[model samples]
Target: MPKAKVGRKKAVLSGNHYTSRRFDVVAVGASAGGFHAIAELLGPLPANFTGSILVVQHLDPARKSLLADLLLRHTALHVKQAEHGEIMLPGVVYIAPPDEHMLAGPGKIQLAHTHLVRFSRPSIDLLFESVAGMYGSRSVGVILSGTLKDGSAGIRAIKEAGGVTLAQDPAEAEFKSMPQAAVATGCVDYTLPLNKLGITLKNLYEAGSPKSYG
Candidate 1:
């Protein structure tokens, strides 16, 4: 995996110390074949990456998910299932608990048992929309390999809110429908292979400010 070069202006030091006015949080949505795609995306990120990552992957509501544990093998960042009312922190990977809708607030997490959207309880659209509303340009939204069109609208919401949005290249995706859908929205800022996605995010973090779309 390629290591990310740290930037001097807002370098993330050991532990939870870093400052930036750009993106503080990243919202990632994925489904079928996501485990591998997500692992590929996160493996290259530096250990002290300065942003929090919130993930919503379509999961079986009837069974317990070992997603956090599985993902821990691929990245140095702290990985765990998100809990309601927990304060969001930099460098942490928070996976939404099965059967719950994970929403973001200002520096915090909110989980709900509300009706499903897009036929899924842990809706990618809901998570992305919530983060877009709360963090605005201070957030980044990513759509990875999956089936169906779950993340399309959410990516649009993020883009409209002045945040960066990215999708996996459909040609490289194991399941291309989801990313293809997002790209069709005409809102994605970048569409790249999995390895490049991580590098791009690292570069964006180092930039220390949101790119002007104007």
Candidate 2:
């Protein structure tokens, strides 16, 4: 993908003028050993976080996922399995349903029953690519603990689209291959420990205008 030009204007403006949040959407991808890492990452975010969080964690299609329920224990934000055509909301955490590819549109969520990529049905690359396409500079992509390089291309797509990209520090990841691969792409802007991700995201979301944040 070619590098997308960063727009000078804000992609979205909230009803409240007092907020200076820059990004509109945050996309996270993980696989093996991701549950604990995700829980830790989401634990510190304030309930009023200004961006919507969309997650794609590899799961077994044969069984129903309890990701939302499990994550609810870790964060104050409302957590649920994303449904097709639902409007994306600030401060909510949406998890991709098992076997479905979750995609972000202008202001809505989309689900596709497409073939798997990288041997994963809910491909992280697909979700991040769609997010990059829809939100451009007003998006964030994160790669967490996992076994494979599923998020590498997706993170690069986000960077190419002028979005911020973050990767968990491989040294701290229970399954380092995923984060390591993302960092190796040379696209990630931050390589942080899991414990710091939530606070960093909070700071990023509460930052000034787009230019100021960039």
Candidate 3:
């Protein structure tokens, strides 16, 4: 098969699909032991954080989402399940709905309930790939505690697109498979402990600094 003429799509912040440096979006993925870990990571981020946060957490399609309420009780950022077509806005945390794939667009969002990636709904790789596609190199992707290999491919996509990628230190992860697999892909730029991730996020947003470790 011939390669597509336009290989990777980009959401530009300027002319000719170019984007100036900015920390306007943050995408996080986790599964297995995500509930507790998410609270720990997001609770410390200030309400004034200057980046929009999108999360893809493994969950049952038939189950109710306590995640938004759970995290809301812990963080100052407004937490809610994402609404299709909503633009990314700083200080708001959008959670991916169950049994759906969440994709990022130019300051906007799109959600689908089609095929699953890696046998999971609210697929992490789907979210990461889409975000990297839209944001180019200006996004942040975090792979947290989980028990499978869901996030590695997504992390690779983000890295290739020039986005900063972070994985929780495997040793510190409650279930290390996901983060460890991501590390094995050789794309992770930071292997932070749970505590430091919050601090790092704060620094990234506040200082307008981009940390690329890999």
Candidate 4:
């Protein structure tokens, strides 16, 4: 539907464990000041959301993961960090372990041993690019508050592959660089505010018709 975003490159196949074979995965990327924004998006998605979700947030590798723990408290969806070889499934939340790039494939999510891109191990671009290869237009990608441009290329890849994309409105982001960079790439479909993201996602699922999420 749109051209791929520039700035970096990244790559995958997602098998069907979701609602339908067409599309059943969504990938999200965040960093800098993204905690609240991420919670806002995840809190409203029902536990029955029929697609796999993969998330990567910028975090200190040396620190214990608090993102999944924090999200568990805010949403009904089961949340956990990616294990060595966990399959991608609907109704669950998969967060990339800090300091490692997450790759989603035919039926699972894996922690990559590859070198980090843009100085961040869990690069948003990596996650998005992988999702594009596997899920294509069926994937939905959202880039939220963050510093730097980790997710820009990922968003573009998603777009090129026929996936949909949304970015938090830069004016509404705690750290606008990431969203701004995504928008600048001209591939993002929606640049919504944090408060409006939940409904937007709900709408996307609804648009998918009988293949709805939750």
Q: For model 3, what is the C-alpha lDDT against the true structure?
A: 0.79
Clashing pairs in 2: none
TM-score of each: 0.88, 0.87, 0.86, 0.87
- In order, candidate lDDTs are 0.85, 0.84, 0.79, 0.80
Write the number of the candidate with greater lDDT, choosing between 3 and 4.
Answer: 4
List the candidate 3 regions with Cα displacement exceeding 4 Å. Answer: 1-21, 209-214
For model 3, the run of ten residues with the poorest summed lDDT: 3-12
What are the per-residue Cα lDDT tens digits for candidate 2 across 1-214? 2221222122221244324436888999999999998998899888877688999999999999999999999999999999999988888899999999999997889999998899998999999999999888888998999988998999999999988888888988999999999989999877777766766676677663432211
Q: In model 4, where is the ten-residue run with the lowest total lDDT?
A: 7-16
Alpha carbon lDDT of residue 63, candidate 2?
A: 100
For residues 45-70, what per-residue lDDT tens digits would candidate 3 score against the true structure?
99877778899999988998888988
- Residue 12, candidate 1: alpha-carbon lDDT: 19
The candidate with the higher TM-score, 2 or 3, is 2
For each candidate in turn, give its C-alpha RMSD to the true structure in angstroms.
7.2, 7.3, 9.5, 7.2
Compose the digit string of candidate 4's lDDT tens values, residues 1-214: 3322232120001122222424578899999888898899988788777777899998998998978888999887898888877677677889898788898887778788688799889889988999999879788999999999999999999999987888888887999999999999999877777666766676566546323433
Candidate 1 backbone collisions, by pair: none
Model 2's alpha-carbon lDDT is 0.84
Instruction: Give the winner by lDDT: 1 or 3.
Output: 1
Which residue window of length 10 is worst by lDDT in model 2? 4-13
